[model samples]
Target: MTILDRLTGFANPAAALRRAVQLFDSGRPSEAFPLMAMAARAGIADAEYRVGRCYLEGSGVPPSRVEGTRWLGRAAKRGSADAQALLAALYVSGLATSEAVKGPASQRLFEQDTLGEPDFVAARELATKAAEAGSATGQAVLGYILTRGPGPMRDADAAHRWYERSAAAGCAEGRLGLALSLARQGGLAERDRIADEVRRAADAGLPTAIYLFAIFTEHGLGVAGDLAAAARLYQAAAEQGLPSAQFRLGLAMIEGSLGDLDPVAGEAWMRRAALAGNVEAAYLLGERNVKYRPPDYAEAATWYRRAAEAGHQAAARALGSLYLTGNGVARDEQEGTRWLRTAATSGNQAAQVDMANLALQGIGEADDTTNVAGWFEAAASSGDLIAAFNLGLCFVKGVGVPRDEGQAAQWLRRAAEGVAEAQYMYARILRDGRGVAADAQQARAWFAQAADGGILDARVALAEMLLNGRGGDRSPEAAVQLFERAAAAGHVGAMFALGALHSSGQGLPIDQVAAQKWFSAAAECGHGQAQLMLGRYLAKGLAGERDPLASRLWLERAAAHGIVEADEEFAEATSG
Candidate 1:
């Protein structure tokens, strides 16, 4: 028989519904809708259910939730299995209720008081009716709700039975629900099997199933880690314009573990997802642009604004940073502080640290040590290295906290593990025996490490220690070598040290001409000591002819750089 003849021959409403299901399954929901609607109007319960589904999901027409609900209610009243199941699921999920619905009101009657009550009994009744029918989707939905025991409904055994029945019907969602239940029961092997079955169903083109499968693969919950596969599946779903899938795909691409790193592409996908109302994608895109130097700051600011509108704490913090730094926007410290406070109160670590700094510096208002300390504490607790270093400084300086050497050392140690500044400070503490046992060798080692990591102060401290034999045996020649290396890298202290050594004939043969040249270079680099020494050489005509005017200029600049000796020498030179 032809397909149409077979469908016409079926007098059973259920059979007619099955024909419509076959049409829907064949990607002809448009054709199936009219037939389903006609059958529903003719008192065919299953047809009523299918028509409701088409309207509810907008598969073949403009969506009409009211019409869908009316048809589903009619089918449910007529004992249509699928319709009853869908209604049960909706009620259990609280999706059937209006968003403005409130809990039952409390009342007092003649001194007896009644508390507000949940409408769980109504939900349970719907779920029970659906579970009694041979609807696997209904069974799974009811099982999930009952197992959670939300409100007054609590029946683990019934949940387990329904889940098992649903699984037997080849329902992928049912299998996943059963797997979760098995996992809770410590049945790892069975849980894995069920999870695998769900994955297979997902591979067979179930939209929700594909999403769950991608999640499992991404997290390696039931399968080996397969981020590439997860990304592919997410991309597929995203191409279909699923907002959640778009966000997931964008995130994976941005992170670059699943495929070739493509920040621009990731940002593009995230932008699309954000426009689709994915708040997380908006937040992530905003953060990436703010921290990673995106090509367009205005676009990034727009995304940040969207996320902030959606109440994303990190995005608010990022927006604040842009405003504070005048990055892609005009500087506005007050607006920046306002946004930072919002994020800081929401426990955003970066915002907390920034808020602390702003408070300490009185950036937008009067300085508040108490508030600054609180923000620093919050940021430090969240593992912010800068905050930890600042906390250590506060302890050492008695800024906001009482001067406690032990606490200073503790916080410094934490920061020292990550920050060059903190490392230098901690190394100084070791060298000076401040709140800790003196360890010269340890101090030298840390200083060297910090210097190598580009801490200018650490480089100077290490060079000084070597020259003066503070932490190790004296090595004037080695100190000169260190100074030369640092000086070549534009370290002002190193340049001054090199110039002094040359002028005093301490490490190598004294060459007056060479000394003059080294001092000139150092002075040009703003080395105050070099400027003063060079000025004296010029005034005395030691390296060349006397040039009083040039000598005075060097002395004046040296004095401006806080050279006390230069001030005295400049006065003497001016008088002469």
Candidate 2:
């Protein structure tokens, strides 16, 4: 095309650029693009920036990052503030695209024409220069870099300041950033301001702002809750390729919050979000696959692995479990341990307990017992009751450290808040004054709790305390009931205690026959005291007709079990 036709008779490059901007403002990018390109070729910096944006977004031409970046570089080199800000943003985002040109030539082009490959340092440098030159877009980009770019560069206060400046300058992205900052501060006034800023930014067509506004509407944050309106806004942002928005819409559809339950469509949206690198979507897909009626274990493993590779701790733990059990992948202890360790090291409490158990079983590494205790402590610090109980045992028994009953009591007491076994152990500590002052009342209380949890030992201990009134008011009736219950469950101690209670008439009417029956039952189960008592009962005909042979036999058994008095009794029975 002739220059006159291309530029529309505007000999001045600035004049052509102004006409192109007017046309673009009127939504005639196709007509404006050629004129903008003409002005760019004539070395107009602002026109070069406009042409670059057009190429980048494919406003009036096919999208090409290579050409777009080239034009942006030209404009940036000529001191175009807008070009500098946009180029910085692209570099910071790694120019995300599967279609990005690659190879040595592409690398050279990126290095020479676009600063470098995803270099945050260079991005920050360009954004700083542009922001200092008073570009609203530059200020917004700089604010983003300060807010979420890198750990070392993050400065929330500084980011808020930059966002405020850019928002005052009328940048929609800046308004969105300012709203996010205000949301974090979290007050009635801040929420109201956030609502206003987010709405304005959404009106300006910012996808992230639309997504935020939708969340606010859905949850009634400084706005009336409206599911339908939130769903519509989610649809708009999702269609714009916002992964979080897509995930939200997917959840809404799956939960029937979008008028109908559409699992197929919901899952499709989730898959799209996952493919777009949404880690939570990937993790959720893995969970769904595993929870299906006929679980797709192989597919679950695949999805879990994807999220795990992206540093999702729950996904790593799930993938590790599958690998360890051979549920989806081949059983690979080394591989499973590696993944479990990955999550454990990242502060996943359950994963830490898993690793400790594996070590205890000698299933993974041949680590010393101390390593197991260390893992338990790590999880215990995060309020894991099982880990706390385990760590307490470790301290009490010196299995993995120096025996320290005081430390054991501390941990076990904390664990006792929820763990039945810990309650039982803590009760023992209280009863014996092992690590703290002996408190019979506390011991009885904890034993009762553990007994209710089905602990046989705790039932016996609590029954004894009740019968003796060691902790509170004596309740022989309650004691007898507890003993009977434990005896039914095959506890030898409870059976022997029941025999004593019957013999003493403590909880029921005195009955020699019942005593003899209970003593014989406990004796048969290897209770030495019960054996001796049973022998005496049989010899004296305490419950029925005497049987000398049975008495001698019982006495002999008790003697063999280390009951000193039974030896003399056995000799007497044999003589008789």
Candidate 3:
């Protein structure tokens, strides 16, 4: 049976109070109200507090904030800490003590004409009484007001004393207040020692304490780190409707920053927090959706727009990219440039680089090297590799910068890490002695690295150097291997080099068939000399079986492409 059922049998104030609590917990505030009212009429202080709360919240009654204030005033006089704090909050926030009403405040009965006059003076007096009556929350709140000095004299010392007393009474908010008061200097306790106090208050069911306790657990502040435990606490606090907790928990779940990754749950939490105006959550949701497998650009734009409206610099840049690419919205270069400018003003490094690119390409604005260099320098200083490459080029050519090959090499060297183009450039500077002493050995090393890193031109250069022994020990065999690799990556020069190598028999055992095969491959790629050579090989059976028709056809095809030797050879063959 419900406590109310048994309490009705007892017909006593104590039983009535207990029954009211049970009903309130059961979400039956209407039922609890009558019992609380009955006890309140009998002069029970705690019951008076319950009556005031019910009226203030309009539990099973029309809302009359004026009447609620009156009841709250009575409860405060009866020494209810919550009642005192509520009244004080109303005054501190400058809420109309008696809110004007229109109709249907059914939960708390309020009358339009009976609106109570807003009274800061009464609120201040009630707060004093509540603090003197040992309300920890009231004392802490009074301490905050005293320290703030809103229309009064500031008293940091008195505020600290009140906060200390509130904390001693086991109030988590009081503990936080005291910590903040001392933070102006150091703190009341060492960082590790304060954990105990916070945990104790959290155990007593304080929201702020619970959040701090979760943080301590996550980071091992004063306890062994336990991220899963922290996540559980975050989940609990999020369910309790804490917005900041919801955003953090959402991120943790999304990134699996804590144990038990749940992307779906994480996204749901982010949506909840975002809807509640959490800018970070909004930005993260935008980032997540944009990077999702197969990407959902439209959805990402919606979230990005929300965060951008709140002045998130990165979101402005991201949205601009989407606009420019026509990924989520219509392609609009002007719009994109506008957003890039916005982010540039905030000194967003990537956005600055993008702006530089836009200016250089003449896409959104006129191509101007001065503007481009300025933007590139801004981004490059932030260690952007591509920006460094572009900036290096600018220094080398005096394009929007002074001609300083040494500076160019400096930036190029920094950008040479696994970047084929940069590697090639660095190697070229070293090999040619451009604004520096030529180091053929170093150049060869860089050329090899760049070739392997996938620069076809570097591969050809390295192969030629190897064949001629210009940079290091001559190795025709190694040169042949380099040519083969470069040709495989579609370099026409490498293909020609391979044909020459096979024909001369410098790298491997002489094989006429192999020579013909290399020549044929090069000829197919429109190498005129290789075409003539292949035709001669076929005509003389030097590389394969003699076939006059095939040879003639090859020479004729080569002559059509304006190869001078092939045309002469064709005329000679035709006359013979």
Residue 263 C-alpha lDDT in model 3: 86
Compute each candidate's TM-score over C-alphas. Answer: 0.63, 0.70, 0.60
Candidate 3 lDDT by residue in tens digits, 308-335: 8888889889999998999989999898
Write down the RMSD of all candidates, one decimal each: 9.0, 6.8, 9.5
Each candidate's number of clashing pairs is: 0, 0, 14
Off by over 4 Å in 2: 1-71, 96-120, 128-136, 146-170, 181-187, 190-193, 220-224, 257-259, 324-326, 360-363, 366-385, 437-449, 460-487, 492-576
In TM-score terms, candidate 1 sits at: 0.63
CA lDDT, every model vs. true structure: 0.76, 0.87, 0.78
lDDT of 1 by residue, 367-420 (tens): 546666677877787788889998888888786678988888888889988888
How far residue 506's Cα lies from its native spot in candidate 3, in Å, is: 9.5
Better of 2 and 3 by TM-score: 2
- lDDT-superior candidate, 1 or 3: 3
**Which has the higher TM-score value, candidate number 1 or candidate number 2?**
2
Better of 2 and 3 by lDDT: 2
Worst 10-residue lDDT window, candidate 3: 96-105
Return the top candidate by lDDT: 2
Residue 508 of model 2, lDDT score:
84
What residue runs in model 3 are displaced by over 4 Å at the alpha carbon?
Answer: 1-162, 165-172, 181-189, 196-206, 218-220, 223-232, 251-263, 291-294, 336-347, 350-360, 364-387, 397-400, 474-477, 495-576
Higher-ranked by lDDT: 1 or 2? 2
